[model samples]
Target chain A: MVDIAAELKRPKIDAHCHVRAGREEELSSQRLVEAGEMLGITEYWCSRPITARYGSLEEIRAGNDAVLAAMRRYPQRIRGLCFVVPGYYREACAEIERCLDAGMIGVKLYHQYKINDPAVWPVIELCTQRRVPILVHAGYVTDPRTKAEQPRLSHGADFAEVSQRFPETMFIMAHIGGGGDWEWTLRALRDSSPNVYVDVSGSNLDDGQVEFAVAELGAQRVLFGTDGTMAGCVGKVIGASLTEEQRHLIFWGNAERLLAAQGKQPLAKIESGQEGVAG
Target chain B: MIFDINAWVGSWPFRSLRDSTPQQLTERLRKAGVAGAAVSQIEAILHRNAQPANERLAESVEPYRDVFVPMATINPTYARWEDDLRICHEELGMKGVRLFPEYHGYEIDGPLAKRVVAACRERGLPVQIPHRIEDMRQRHHLDPARGVPLAAIAGLVAAYPDTPIIVTNARGIAQSPLWRRTELRDAAWYADTSLAEVYFQGLDKDLALIVEESGGRHLLFGTHAPFSYPEAALVKRATLPADADTLEEISYRGAMRLGLTPESWAVKAGSA
Candidate 1:
């Protein structure tokens, strides 16, 4: 009666989808919600425009508001995470402040802006001061990742300095460090930084890093994030290590805790994240 | 009711024992809600001779006896090809034989490859061959040599139209409308859900076209183990937007059609 079955049947969260200023520009947030519903994915955190040229506060707000509008259409199923280039901190911080006021839960950093660069240092300061999690694109750039992975933002190596600089701030490394130049990224996640949590998004876990990561960093640290393409979501999660209880955590429990702590409501149904199109 | 024709049961050198064991793998299969699977050995593919590995594979099928069927890997290049096929057929009762022509380094049209394909045909055996596992680029080589061409396999299937040959490694089937143009009507292909899926490439016409052209009976669910996660394939197969009848044909009956039961296989000269 708890609708646990329906909730269990709910779609997975696509932690890193994009708006592209085109794909979803005119489509109603309801259609976006429908897309998520069809796939049983209830959440979409838009993080495209990850480049230096996308270095304006206005660009961040446009993408951020697009995602927020989707969330508004299906309040229970959507949440928007803001994207910013670390090279422009004041601009990035200004957008983050706006997103925070609008109830965003996390900050997204593209590798185009070096994590170690002074430009991003202030963005981290802002996110940390506000206690929002920052997700970074960490992995090898040349490893022939699918076309969905673009703009080889600096690998996890760029951010080792950032994590060291701010130990209390939460850092989520997308792809769990195995995408490319993975070993060092894994090393950083496991040893170099305490607040760093790795997600198996848009990466292959076939090499046993998922279990190893769970062993090194508790299951709580491995957040589930897919690059948000249909196939990417399936491939990333199908190969993870969480047991029945833990899968619930990676899928939603952990996200629910993080969102609730920030005053957000968990999606109650499987249709919350549906894309609006019927085809 | 969903049958996963392309899955594996054996220890993988790199993947942990959890996804490799029969019990663990079967449970994982069941979790995907597949009714049955046609299993082969990943460990055997590593065997240099493919004899002990074939023998080892036949034995691996014991635990999942009810829900699983055996597939033997044959390296006809091995000096004992005749003996390996005998043991695989008579002793272990494997339903089919899988070949790795690339790893074995033989052309599908070559004498040895044709001989193995013919041997299975003579004994009413279904033959399977994996093209390549994992993203070929991610594998050991940097863009390893191309798999035995689908056209080449089309040639083999055309040669022996009576024998059912299931090719597991052909990534080209989903893209080629030529599957409809093939002269081999008795010939068919199995889509390893692992390799069957198209990703960020944004090209998904292959599966739809193949399903339509082959009338769905030509498709079977397979997962190239140690190469891809089986659950992903299952999800892909389940999510295929085909009609109910077509879905049943591809997911379940197609594999059964590829199989030769003990009775049919046991049919001998005296009975004939």
Candidate 2:
């Protein structure tokens, strides 16, 4: 058996993580960083889960504040994303400015409105002008419950439409494995420009899913993301049918390139001596 | 040695997959420390009649009897499904039979299904139901196949409490409330780990919960290989928080309920 703990020591970055401040059941900054250290994750790009927990504008601000606070607390290990409810256009834009002013690198959008809805155009345009990537919640609409809750939730086709409309904006389709028709989503995005990328996160670990993503989008277009767990994300990449270089790209290299594009530097690198330490 | 209850052989037309042939698959499994797998053919799920593909599967695994246990697919919708089951048990000596109700365009509670279930019970053969052959989202664009409904499967399990019934490729059902149903929990029904991954808050809580609720004896280790990487399942298995004995039960012992024994597989002399 592969020593997963040992394999995790290789420097990596989790591009998609949720920080639940004040919620002990959820991950705190200290716990998140500690988990990252054990799993070889050098940095985490975080958004606040509180925004989704409570949908009011005040709660949304609180969520963004939590991300900012976590980033401040763990400057070396945490990166912040400005969480916005696109329906509240002005407040959303203001929050984006506040996060960017505070050195947050990107934007994280949830299911407040459809990805392609006209109301979200301003936020997309702002992020495009700022040259920051927007990580959108694009999951499969499987059952009645999900369909009812997120009637306008973005799928692969919707994401494709959004990416096409704003070619300059970099959009990360969150959860390529999140229970919606991923195959349809992948195929829909197959011909999409390089501006569109995917995050390998979410709860579903269907076999060959990572490989399928890599095959369809190429390693460069796929970024390693753990919807908030190192073990979940790390295992998918580590257990994939990938070479050392491909694994490195998914684990850290691809994320590094994305972060570097935003003028951010990883806090640390996996030293050559650290390779295969646990193995 | 891991025993994968949900491995497959044969090409998938929808997407390109590695390790399709028996040799490629076994080499892949062996590298991941998989000692054996109960495998079926992908063609069985795609074809109108699954008998030809079933025969091919038996023939393909004949050369590697020690590692690959052939599980034949019988489409009850087909006219010759009874003969197919007989050939699988009497002729090929297959201990398990897989049914693809959705792919075959039939419901699990249909009269045909009742007949098939009765036959398997009479013959002392285990019936395996694959809830979803491919992630419905990733299935061939033109082929609009979906998984067998969880309720339908529960009804069938309720009807035949005495027969050994294993559900494979059921990632969604395992996470649902139905997984904890008293009727299912009381019956001789088992679930394969092919689609049972649960990643939440840095913990594999779904797997832990399933093992806790169903008991380790009701879970079987499955990779859904060729369609999925064997290493993925092995990695999940390794990370399961269960003790060594419980892990042993999930990996191999649970499968013994289907009447498989280590001695039943004949490893050729000098074979790796």
Candidate 3:
């Protein structure tokens, strides 16, 4: 019998997540970690919450600083993703170096510029040299409301283009469900190079989405994420028709590979005897 | 045992759904720990006349009658829908009705909708209105149905205070102005937890907050299955910060009070 309850309690990594520092917001950082922990999410690969402004260096630094603080507050539960805007190529590259030096495992890019834009190439190249994955803000916003709000949002086509240009760099397309038009996004991702992976996260709990992503992108290219909605995030994967191996890959195995490739380690081992690292 | 108040059968044109047949739906529900579900037909939303869809739903679920409670959909805008409602209630033995105001192109507070609600009230059957079938942002471009706002549902509730209204696939109820109103609180209405969430995009909103806002009385356990994963609601229910009584109420009691009885025979030997 498939012990689904035990599977739900397995130590999983949420690849795309956000937390707020207690500075401007309340102790939402603590709440995000607690909520994920309650659902057996052992680690959060998180960045500061996305904002409307991605053009300012000060804002970029502020976001990364918040993530650093969250990492310090929950050293065992949180792993930092350095947030940066690639429009400032030189400064963006420098920030990547600073964050990686400070122990962040990956880079998070938002919608100031498309991932394929020439402005972002240097940042991609920097991450490639540093052996860290770039978690790019991706969505195919077809609806008027999201379109108007995220006119510059990156889509699967952008990832396809960027991934091909920099074949050596690994790219994670953020939030297949969070992005508008998931079906369209999945179709677009079919042409993306193998380096482009998609995270199954967001509040839209539509059935068959996780299975569809695994089918379209292949199981190895899919990662589990909450994007803030923890239960829905975990549930969509559990609800989908997947084998134990596919579930493990999406839940933690693929994340383990990514973390290992980046030469990072979880601050604490999983107490459930489900070691996050495959040693 | 969890009783899912919202579920569907039939093919959705935009996307292919898994486990949508009556037999398939039961297995899906069982895997998610749901003992029974009140199911509606998806084709009714798109069909100009819903009687055929209702007939299909009744026939499809005939084999698995104990595990599935057939809920008919009647587009009041269609001609002679009262007769269809009568056939569904009297002949088909459907427990209740589900309406699609946005897809059927009728206002929630319009005369046609009122007739449906009034008739259901007279029959002592609850009316379930799905706030949306598909998420608006990701819906097929050709499909232009918008979500029925909470205010419109609230308007219907105010007009027919005695009618039992169950709103499924609803979002942002806790944040809406109608939340916690005396009429909503006191009425025999409920909102299912299929689409409810604890947090989204860094906001402290969704299910847990909704339960806190409503004091857990107005919530029901729902999966929106086949269209949505049953595990979504199941996980949300598992994480609710409620005591045993409140959890029981949300899980099955609220559904029971709505006149939905989980067939005792459907429970496995050791479950009860």
Candidate 4:
């Protein structure tokens, strides 16, 4: 019998979490990290949250700065993902170099430009050469209202197209359950690109989502993420009808392998009973 | 023991569900450490008349009475609903009734809704209102289902302050304007911690934040399972930064307060 409560206590990695640096974002960041800790998350891949559809160059830099700040504060618990807007090619490339030099593990992209957009190509190539993953914010929105609203939001097909082009670059699709039709998103992701992996994040928590994603995309291409809903994400993984090996892969094995290949190690010294020790 | 206040055992027409049958639901719930669940039928939401669905629910759950607390589904808009409600309570031995105002095509705070609540109240039965059966964003293009708003629930609770109200599969109840109203807040009302779970926003918006905000008194454990995975809700409850008392309140004590004690119900039925 599966002891789910005990299973939840197993150490894992949260592949997608937003940890910001602004006055208010700091509190949100702290809560997210604390929640992850309570849920036995060992490493949090932190990114700067972008509220606007399109952010200024300064905003993008500032977002990456916040992630860097979080990494400095919780060196073991937090792993920074450099956020950039591919539309700002030169600046975005420069920010990626700066963040990567400062120990950031990968890149985080939003819908400012679709993954397949020409402007994003160089960014993908840069990450591919650097041997880092590009985590793209994607939504397969079937809802006409949201679809019209976020016309530029990248989808599974966009990732499929872009990923096929840069077969060497590892691509992490943001959230299958965040919004839009996850079923449609999973269906689109099926047998598309081996380079394209998806994070089981977001608040949807639909039954059979994790199982379906595993079956559709294969376990190696599925990652664990909360996108802020920490417990729900953990629950989706533990609750699914997966082999222990599959659960391990989703929880931290895939991430551990992927980051290790990029010469990145998130947890240097896993601390216990460390709370409210902000730098 | 964990008593899940929100769960369903029947096929969802829009999407294929795993472990949607009573036996499968029982096995899944047990694996997740849930001792019992208040289960309804998924077909009841879309079926023209909910009587047949309720009958099916009774038969399906009969074999798993130890794990299932059957809740009848009533479409007040359908004719002879009163008779169906009576049969569900008396003959079918249902513990409660769940209403789908949005799916049933009627105003939640309208006279017909009030009549159902009043009738259930007289029978000392709780009324469960699921905010949405499926993720509103992921519904089939042809399926036009909408979620039950917090405002409509406020209206229902304000009108019937003494009625035991269970609002399941809802999000943002604690942060809603209606939740701040004394009339709705003080009533014998409960919301499940299924859909309104942890999110990236500030602690005040999701279920984790509300455990402190509402003292866990107004919250109950729910999976909205088969439609949603039960593990998500179970893990969410385990991660709540709450004291033992608060956790117990949300897990099963609150449900017990709502008269979900099958032991007492059986004794009462036998005596009657």
Candidate 4 lDDT by residue in tens digits, A14-123: 88888756775567667666765667787889888565666887888888888887787777778889988888888889999999999998999888788889999889
How far does residue A186 in candidate 4 sit from its true spot (Å)? 2.1
Candidate 4 deviant stretches above 4 angstroms: A268-279, B198-202, B264-272
Fnat per candidate:
0.10, 0.24, 0.62, 0.64
Q: What tens digits encode model 3's per-residue C-alpha lDDT throughout B1-272?
A: 68899999999998898899988888888877888899989998998998999999999988887788889898998889999999999999898899998988999988989999999999989999998898777767777758887888888998887888888987666676456566567776778888867555335666676677665677889889988888888877888777788888898777777766445433542376
Which ten contiguous residues of candidate 1 chain A have the minimum total lDDT? A270-279
Checking candidate 3 for backbone clashes, the offending pairs are B197-B207
Candidate 3 per-residue lDDT over residues A1-279, each given as its tens digit: 233465567778889988775474336677766676667787888887455865567777878888888788887878889988788889989988998898889999888788888998889889998889999888887678877777789888888877888887889999888847787778887777887899998878889889889889889999999887788788898778898789888987788888888777655455444543221
Q: Which regions in candidate 3 have their CA more than 4 angstroms from the true location?
A: A1-4, A21-26, A271-279, B180-183, B199-205, B213-216, B262-272
lDDT of 2 at A80: 90
Q: Write the per-residue lDDT of candidate 2 for residues B1-272, one digit (tens) a residue.
A: 56888888997777667888999898877867787888888888879888889889989989888788888888888887888889888898687888887778778877888889999999998888887766554344566557787778778888898888888767555555447566577788877766665334443356657776656856788878877556556655765667888988888877755765334532421153
Q: What TM-score, to 2 decimals, does candidate 1 have?
A: 0.73
Clash count for each candidate, listed in order shown: 25, 2, 1, 0
The C-alpha RMSD of each candidate to the native structure, in angstroms, is 6.6, 4.5, 2.8, 3.8
> What docking tier does model 3 reach?
medium
Worst 10 residues of 4 chain A by lDDT: A270-279
**Quality of model 2 by C-alpha lDDT:** 0.75
